[model samples]
Target: MSTLNRISTPLTELTGVEHPIVQTGMGWVAGPRLVTATAEAGALGILASATMSLRELEDAITEVKSRTDKPFGVNLRADAADAEQRVNLLTKYEVKVASFALAPKPELISRLKEHGAVVIPSIGSVRHAEKVAAWGADAVLIQGGEGGGHTGAIPTSLLLPTVAAAVDIPVIAAGGFFDGRGLAAALAYGAVGIGMGTRFLLTSDSAVPEEIKRRYLEFGLDGTVVTAKADGMPHRLLRTEFVQGLEGAGKLAQLLPTLRRTVQFKNMAGQSWLELARDGLAMKRSSGRSWNQMMLAANTPMLLKAGLVDGDTEAGMLASGQVVGVIDELPSCRELVDRIVDEAVVQLKAAAATVRSA
Candidate 1:
């Protein structure tokens, strides 16, 4: 049952985990239960904090700690108004790793490092990987265009080696990664490990409702679509009726619903109208998003919550990678990790034999 012998890379050494697999922090999907289970299973588990309030995040970190003594990470929105407070919380809790979706300020990275926490940021391009490395990031997670949620246009096969060669730090490959074959392929691409969001979300340990999980399993390789209609950013999502409707609808046609969801998200996240406006303004400045795009951004969290947390596929958005179509069953974290490791070892040995014969 122990499959640790299959891999030993800088990622496993840096994170102090037995395996180099990382369960990414998907908004509203990655929670304390799933994170604790992944950590216990010997992979790095990152708790998604973007959807949680400051108090909620604190409680979640404590809960995960209570559940497992193994090391784990917390993913943060570096652009959040309370980013500083969240960093302090990580320092206070003595969390092992701090991950960011957007590049954090150099000072923030320094602060985390000072507090004895490893800093890893998810990047979509080679330049971004280089920038974070120069800013002293401990590691970088690179996600290709095939990743779920907001993604870029580059495929992992192309992006991985580009970024891996661009940075001196360890690179973790993500997007379209589901099984042991992917693990072997990523390693061949010079990545130290692989990060998986959709694969982990479909696991038995994930808190997503069973009905929604079943819905996800129904998708084929072509069951997903990349649309900018969701948040004015290219988002990879399941090709549900709701998504098709969004694709066909005009901007004006979608405006009213987007605004309503905006208000709902504002309330759910416990942000005042003024605070939401300020965050929107910050996003606009940082990302160079137009007014329309910024307005649409408000709809993302609520829509995700509806589908992932409430099991309302008709009205909610399911952020997923293209790999969902290929995954057919839900395995517990331990079983899934062990299976991948064992399979990877077999594949590597077979390849070595081929090399010898050649």
Candidate 2:
């Protein structure tokens, strides 16, 4: 439907999309406008439901439906206190695909599959991929350490093939990918497709402020860094002065602001202290993080809101992948997807010509 060449793969087949590309659901950045644009472009555009309340998420889904009949997905936090309610929202709207930020429970996968919704969870390890495949997920999306936000240390080049080989389901690779060349490389690595977060966030369809977008464009490859100071876990972010400040500060100095943001995130997320505690307990059990780490984890939403929503770089933390260095312009989602697919077809054909059967 998107007026462009088609590059089909198992990803397109599994998700019923025209292109083997995914617009990742970056919190605050992946809203209705961006998702609608992506769907219109014939790629799977995932709405970031992790940063929304149940009401907001419903409204977003409704908005996208009104804009386009094309298929789109919603990204959910499997560890959320109301994950079941979120999953129910998808069924209520008849959402075509449901993606998770973590490995979802077996029953959740069963419920989604029973409703005929495709289940794809993001994993960082072969073990995670095998576990989810055994749970009957339709597919798996695995991001390497080169990805932004909370991430692992494994680079995608090595992780992609390993996971692709271990799972019977299709593998969609993420991290350090931005163009058709990356897509071609991913397909060669046995991936069915590629997912991109930073590249999509830099697009014209994204709601991120113009000032923030300009700042992102100025970053070189070394302009990004992975630091655990923000939430007591490895997080990839733009190397901004604010992040540097956090890195330089002692734990005692960081605690006060961390606690403050935690409360702010709680309020903005519409969760009471009791609900936060319940969610925190679940995170502890799953992640094995200390109470301090759990408390710091609450800082992510508000800090991201300050930078991404309120446009306050001085007080905000910006999540980004190393690919930010090579990206220099903002194109609409349709333009981006079309160019990638067209170029991928060329690259794939060119690669085929270079090899011969023995």
Candidate 3:
């Protein structure tokens, strides 16, 4: 038997995973193969289902089951018109966790817990965290401004400890986390664990295309730009020519391409015009974004798909964090998790020794 010291936290106990490191549900990046690899490596790997159809989500869940019995999660959009149907699929597959970008309805939370699925919502503010915790969220993953994809303005160093102190439920700190030192810092902030997106995306086990991953490696901390133009939300993306054009273009200039990608996304997702409108309306109501912004939302899936899945850097936008600068190698999930845990243990021990000497 191996004798590596394993670290446990409220996150591990809640998710039933061996480590508190989580491969966040990054669209296009988190899929079955990557989830399986992360799961086998003893971390919680969340399947990104926001880009999937209901059928695709079920199929992906089944595929993951065939590959490993270890615990994993599915990320869902609470505002999606078919949210209830997707929740039913979670119980149908006996999924271990249901993670959401928005605070799911209280009823959904109760039902998910009833079915034994841990409900963790990604929140950006203390108020949102408190709301979800009051709604019975098992845990909350809070992403700060430095995070990849859609993010808020505050960095994790400021937001994490504030949210952790406000909520009774376990808080998972995300944004700017990649190594054991990040995990140790999160623990020091009273967080249950650290959730990583760019870190996990750069892993060899990630399904992201090799060239795309290499492109990500080429960026430094200054490489990422948070532009609301991509999706009408403050989204942190790589400083690519495509994104730069987006920044420089007028609404009229971007309209045609945005509409084109919308149609492409509708066909790929198999969403009817009516379904698309309803999702957009729901998003508009929740986010208070304009109709133009609602239409702009279609660019996210296709652009990310083109970049992460198809490797067309010019046509695609790269979602990334500042952590991409410090990351140079693509380690496998097992190596990543083992080293993170090992290093965290050493860091924690050294701190304890410092206290005794003081």
Q: Candidate 2's error at 166, in angstroms? A: 0.7
**Cα miss at 275, model 2 (Å)?**
1.0
lDDT of 1 by residue, 107-175 (tens): 999999999999999999888889999999999999998899989999999999999888899999999
In terms of lDDT, the poorest run of 10 residues in model 3 is 1-10
Candidate 2 lDDT for residue 165? 89
Cα lDDT for residue 29, candidate 2: 92
User: Worst 10-residue stretch by lDDT in candidate 1?
Assistant: 1-10
Candidate 1 Cα misplacement greater than 4 A, ranges: 1-6
Query: TM-scores across all candidates?
Result: 0.98, 0.98, 0.98
lDDT of 3 by residue, 1-358 (tens): 2227788899999989999989999999899999999999999999999999999999999999999999999999999889999999999999999999998999999999999999999999999999999999999999999999999999899999999989899999999999898899899999999999999899899888898898888898899999999988999999999999999999999899999999999999998999999988887887888888888898999999999999998999999998989999999999998889988999999999999999
lDDT of each residue in 210-327, candidate 2, tens digit only: 9999999999999998998888899999999999998898888988888888888788878888998998998888888998888778888888989999999999999999999999
> Which is superior by lDDT, 2 or 3?
3
Clash statistics: count for each candidate: 0, 0, 0
